[model samples]
Target: MDSYRNSDARPPIMQGSPPAMVPPRLDWDRPPWNRWAFQHIREILPTAEVWRGTGHRHRLE
Candidate 1:
């Protein structure tokens, strides 16, 4: 895995001016653009808060 961590590694997609190589688009369903879009879904899609409550913790089976 260390071989994949080089100087040429893809930089994190950030807000503001778009990075080179990665195409920019409003539709996140496409490739490359979807990579950043999916990672930042809260920024693009409508979201709501779900209350889990401070009750007993459920164990996963």
Candidate 2:
């Protein structure tokens, strides 16, 4: 069971390399905050459902 124990205690690594990039620190009034908010608007906002807006139909004749 040594292998199993080691696997559980090992730190997570990305292919033994450092993280691809570190996200910038967040400040409540900084652009990073606004940028993050805009990108995640769907999660924070109570959006209406998007109904079927396309008219494409199957033509299997």
Candidate 3:
């Protein structure tokens, strides 16, 4: 990583400090199996779109 830094682009005064690392958003460190379970459940029971209310019962002749 040190080779990537250029003196012309970056000043030599900031060499003492290390680069900052960003943490994962959703606990990526966990095992893949745990993540797969959550993804599958969402697909099985997806939200439904309700168009109309319950219709009234009709009388037979």
Candidate 4:
């Protein structure tokens, strides 16, 4: 059995180092940098759930 086949396996990204040698301000939609940015999206772009009402249920269209 291959080690990579294990369910716990997490493949190394950018050979297990930070994505760049001298990190530029990331474009975030490009390759390489996009990989790291996407992994940490929750930290970069925070979100909140909006409560519509307490006693009313909204119908889905």
Candidate 5:
């Protein structure tokens, strides 16, 4: 879908080799920027892996 986009949404914001409308570091949670920021958070922010499993099982009700 290289040439397909949803008409309801604004044209692509951050994309391409250099990307567009790169939101400021302090504006990711604000209007206009939040739309894209919230969608691609993993790529924009520094993150660490979390242990989501019970490493040691214990008897519980």
Candidate 6:
């Protein structure tokens, strides 16, 4: 498995300004890329904020 982290040569996916790799929009959710895609879903897909009335207060650990 390729580390979600960058390899010796290149930066991690989507790290650079124009993005290092944009795996086809159709397969952005596929194996190798899904790792990063899932973490940045709001940026990758069109998402609207839901009114949950003040989301989780605890900062990410």
Highest lDDT against the true fold, candidate: 5
User: What's the count of clashing pairs in each model shown?
Assistant: 0, 0, 0, 0, 0, 0
Residue lDDT tens for model 6, 1-61: 7785656676466665675656678888998989988888887889998776766777668
TM-scores of all candidate predictions against the true structure = 0.41, 0.29, 0.18, 0.31, 0.48, 0.47
What overall lDDT, based on C-alpha atoms, would model 1 receive against the true structure?
0.69
| Alpha carbon deviation, residue 4, candidate 3 (Å) | 21
lDDT of 6 at 49: 83
Candidate order (TM-score):
5, 6, 1, 4, 2, 3
TM-score: model 1 vs. ground truth: 0.41
In the range 1-61, model 5's lDDT, one tens digit per residue, is: 3445654567667557475657789888899899988888877798788876968877888
Go through the candidates in order and give each one's C-alpha lDDT: 0.69, 0.57, 0.52, 0.62, 0.78, 0.77
CA RMSD of all predictions? 12.3, 11.9, 13.7, 11.1, 11.2, 13.7
Give candidate 1 misplaced runs (Cα > 4 Å). Answer: 1-16, 19-30
Q: Give the TM-score of candidate 4.
A: 0.31
Judge candidate 6 against the unseen true structure and give its global Cα lDDT, from 0 to 1.
0.77
Better of 3 and 4 by lDDT: 4
Return the lDDT, model 4, position 34.
71
Which residue ranges in model 2 land beyond 4 Å of their true spot? 1-8, 12-30, 49-61
- lDDT (Cα, tens digit) per residue for candidate 4, span 14-46: 784654433235565467767767776665567
Prediction 3 global C-alpha lDDT: 0.52
- Show the lowest summed lDDT stretch of 10 residues, model 3: 20-29
Residue 5 Cα positional deviation in candidate 2, in Å, after optimal superposition: 14
Candidate 5 regions off by >4 Å?
1-21, 55-61
lDDT per residue for candidate 2 within 1-61, as digits (tens), equals 4677776755676775764432343543356566655666565556777776689877788
Q: Could you give candidate 1's per-residue lDDT for residues 1-61 as a string of tens digits? A: 5565675767766845554433454667578678877777677679889998999989989
